[model samples]
Target: MKHFLSINSCSSQELLELLELSIDLKKLYKSNKRVLCLAGKSLAMIFEKPSLRTRMSFQVAMTNLGGASVYVKPEDVGGIGKREPLKDMARILSGYVDGIMVRTFAHETATGLAEYASVPVINALTDWSHPCQAMADIMTAKEHFGKIEGLKFAFIGDGNNVARSLAFGCAKLGMRIEIASPAGYELDKGSIERANAIKPGTVVQSSDPIQAVKDADLIYTDTWVSMGQEEEKAKRINDFQGFQVNMDMLKAAASHVRVMHCLPAYRGYEITDEVCECENSIIFLEAENRLHFQRALLKKLMSSN
Candidate 1:
């Protein structure tokens, strides 16, 4: 079965194809056309973490593609790893649904679901990676910049799943990606290795945000403290003191640099309100692309299988 657990799970060529489909899908949607590619199909969405974009996008994506979706709330499932075996739940869901999309705190839970599910399983969001978010991000960048290759993408903040996924996707597509994070918060070793393998010397890890965004065409930042890290919020806020992407940081980037944040942003923390609301920010467009990109992803993953 095919699964989208990480950006590296798909080859460079496959990622390009998915991006192309996403662009085509966006065009189609804007033209007021209806696509019934997944007619009579259904997707089972399992969410362990509450979200606005992830949930709404996937549900709307299914609806746009003529597929119905059933949302399984976090409490309804009794937590996959504890109440019931992940493998057992995966098997059961696979029998009834055409596909499964899961958002969880643990990366292993997402992987475990894919292991036993007969149908394709997509990692909606996990601690280790957010592949769907990465796809939308790439689609947004490509739409704005006219191309993906050779663009300098810079990520500033904790090297969490969003950073890892964005770096992995950019590197795979031949774009230069640099990440600036505080000490001990670098991107995952596995993700770094995979990106390096795809495009040698394409990923740069730095502690200096100024140097990272020196020539960047795109600047990305996410919340410093993610779900399950609420206890360490104070320390994280202290550690990420100078990592904020404000107007000063934009001055160091390219003249046409675009700022992005995977929302629920701590306005004054990881980024400033002035920067997010500025004319150069494509944050809202990036968020909206999730719906279109996931629509293409669902069709690609389910229609083929």
Candidate 2:
């Protein structure tokens, strides 16, 4: 993989390979075996948008792979696209680091970095997509189900970046994705179309939470209000009144259906505390697999061509 800016950047076969690699790495980690695929590499991590999971996961992933990471705080580079052009920073970082991983507000910042960098660029997160999170989510599902094909995955809440990436990634992997969001918060039409092109009739969108979660093998939800949208909190709360993934919603899904959240969860809002703390919740497992999946991705992107 040259870059991992978006799930669409990878083919279905490539995603499966990454998932398999993640499984192997996870087993090795569990067995206390050292697998240093990126023995001598160095990754430069840039955080335009701060995150606990993104920062810790990538840092631990690099260390586990026998490599090191340099954390570039937001102020260090004057915040990407603020002090200078993303291309210039990308060019400069490529000369020093083996690979670049950046979490930014704009998706184009990631694209801009990839355009100029000589090394691989990974999009840790952006306003338009969070591909890394999608990878970890898929990895968690595959771990439970043994395979992801033909599984019904339902996302209930704001159709934000996480939801968008999940839709794209799930559809590409032959999993049908049903997303239920408020009218104004639906997944971008273009993204839905693109996903449909990959797996016809796999991407389904609705405004009803029941329709989205009905018989789904996995139920997912994310915060209705994201980092930069604090001003819309009250309005969003009112808009998403019945969208919470509570126990009642879980009952609509399969008996053994799993629950997933991408983290920094606001309990009683997007998801209730009951559901999040339930036996079916794999949220922590999903969070932990972020390290393994990302370690595999870093190894693939930085260790070789």
lDDT of each: 0.90, 0.91
**Candidate 2's error at 23, in angstroms?**
0.3
lDDT of 2 by residue, 133-229 (tens): 9999999999999988888889998888988899889778988889998889999999999999988898888999998888799999999889999
Residue 207's lDDT within candidate 1 is 95
How much is the lDDT of residue 276 in candidate 1? Answer: 91
TM-score of each: 0.97, 0.98
Query: Taking the tens digit of each residue's C-alpha lDDT, what string does model 1 give over 99-209?
Result: 999999889998899889999899999988998998898899999989988988889988888888887887789888899999989987777887888788778889999
Which runs in model 1 stand beyond 4 Å of their true positions?
A: none
Give residue 164's error in model 2 in angstroms: 1.2
Distance from true position, residue 54, model 1, in Å? Answer: 0.5
- The residue ranges of model 2 lying beyond 4 angstroms of the native Cα positions read none
